[model samples]
Target: MPEAYATSAVASGATGFAPTGGVQPILSVKHIEKIYGTKDSVTHALAGVSFDVAPGEFVGIMGPSGSGKTTLLNCVATIDTVTSGHILIGGRDITNLRTRELARFRRDELGFIFQDSNLLDTLNGFENISLALSIKGAPANQIAAKVHAIAETLGVSDVLKKYPYQMSGGQKQRIAAARAMAAEPKLVLADEPTGALDSRSATVMLEAMEMMNVQFGATIMMVTHDSYAASFAKRILFIKDGTVFNEIRKGDTSRKDFFSRIMEVVSFLGGDASDAR
Candidate 1:
C-alpha cells in the first residue's frame, strides 16, 4: 500500500485545501461485477464498473433508484461481495482479504456516515465522537485531543456536551461527521448524509463535509441522489443501469456552476428535476 493513503495531520492554519497532487489513488475499482439471484432470474446490479479516486479527492456517486449506485458503494465498502473483478484501497486488494481480516481492515481503513446521524442517545456528543477512537484502541490520554480537534473542525465544539436528543438534526449530523473523521480512516464513505435534514440543515451538513475534504484532506466518496449535495464534491460519477454513464470535474468552476452541470447530467440520466434540488 502506498504511504500517501495513510492518515496524516491536517496542515494547521491552511485555508484552502486542494487535491493531493500526483499521489497514488486511494481507491480503485477495476472491472467490477455484481450479480444476484439464480440463472433463471438474475439481477445485474453492477456490470464492469471501474473508477479511481485520488488521494484527498471528494467524489460523489449519483444515480436514480435501481441504477446500482448503492450496490456499487456496498461492494466498495465490503458490505457486499463482488461477483467478479477487484477493489483495491490504499494499494490493498480488499476483495481478496480473508473473512477475519475484513473486519480489521474496515475498522482501520474506512469511515462511514449514513443517512441518519446514528449517534447513541445514551452518550453525549463528546462521548459519541470519542467512541470511534475508543473502538480503535487509541490511547486514553490522547482521545480527548483527537475528538476535540474534529469536533472543532466540524463546528460542533460548543454542542459537545449535549446528547443527541438535545441537539438539532444538523448538530447531530455534524457530531456524526466529527466521529467519522476523528478516526482518521484512509477513506470516508457517506451514503445520503443529508437525506434526513431540511434544506437549511442540509446546507450546514454539506458545508461541514466540504471542510472535511478541503481543510482536513479527508478522502471521501459520497453516494447521493441529490445534485445539490453532490455539488460539494470535486468530482462526480453518474451511474445508470449498473454502468458509469457520465463523469464531471469541478475544476476551477464555481459551485453554482458545478451544480448546474450536475443537474444537467442528472436530467440526462432520467432523474427528476425536482430531485436535483
Candidate 2:
C-alpha cells in the first residue's frame, strides 16, 4: 500500500477548514489502488489514481465506461475503500475513519447529485428539501427559512409546493440540487448529473451548478462521459485504465472550443474511434 498524501490543517472562518495554501486541494487522492478478488485472481478497479480539488474550484472527471471514473469518485466520497493509497478531505484522512465516523463525516461534509432526480415522490419539493434538514435534526423554524433561501438561490422557490412528478425534469433536478446545497457541505460530488435531461434541461442544470460553485464558493467534482457537460467545468481530468491520462484547463477558450478539445482527447483515448455517430 502506498502512503497517504500528507496535509496541513488550518481554520478558516467558522468552517474549521485546513485549505492547502495557494493550489492546496480540499480533496486529495494519492496513489490509490482498489483490487477485487483473491491474490490468485485480481481485478484492478483502480490503479495509481491521484488528483486534488482545491476549495471553490470546479473539476470534471471524464473517462470511458470502465476507466474507473466512478470508482475514483466513490473512493474520494468515502463510500468505498481503496486497497492502497489514501484519500484526504479537508486535510483529514477519510480512508482511516470507521464506518459510523465515515457516515457522520459524509453527512456533514459532502453533498451528492446523481443522474436520477432521487427526490421522494410523496414529498412536496419544499418538504423534500427540508427533509434533509429534518434528518440532520435541524429546528422546524430554521428548516423553513433554510429551504426558502436555498430554493430561491436555485430558482425553484416557486415550485416548492409541487411534487416531483408534477415538475419538469429540469425542475426536479433543480430541486435536487437545491436540496443538496441546503446542507452546506464542504464538497459536492455529482455523477452524470445531467445524464437524464434533454439538451435544454441539461444546460439549465449545468448553469445552476456553475452558479453554486461561483456564488457560494462550493467546491465540486463531477464525473461524466460527455464533453458538453465537462466543458462547463473550469478544469477537466481524463482518466484511462484507472489512471489520469490528461488534464485541460479552460483558459481563455470559448465553451465550444473547449468541448472540441475534450472530444479530441476522448478520440485519442478511443484510438481514433470517437464522436457520437
Candidate number with greatest TM-score: 1
Question: What's model 1's overall lDDT?
Answer: 0.86
Tens digits of lDDT, candidate 1, 1-277 = 1221122321111111223465678998888989999999999899788888898899999888998999999999999999999999999999999998999988889999989989999999999999989999999999999998888888899999998999999999899999999989999999999999999999999999999999999999999988899999999887778877667788999998889888877766677543444
TM-score of each model, paired residue for residue: 0.90, 0.88
lDDT of 2 by residue, 119-224 (tens): 9999999999998888777888789999998888888989999999899999999999988888888899999999999888998999999999989889999999
| Top lDDT model | 1
Candidate no. 1 TM-score:
0.90
Error of 1 at 239 (Å): 0.2
Candidate 2 has a TM-score of 0.88
lDDT of each: 0.86, 0.82
Q: Which stretches of candidate 2 lie over 4 Å from their true place?
A: 1-21, 271-277
* Residue ranges of candidate 1 with Cα displaced over 4 Å: 1-22, 273-277
Candidate 1 lDDT score at position 194: 92
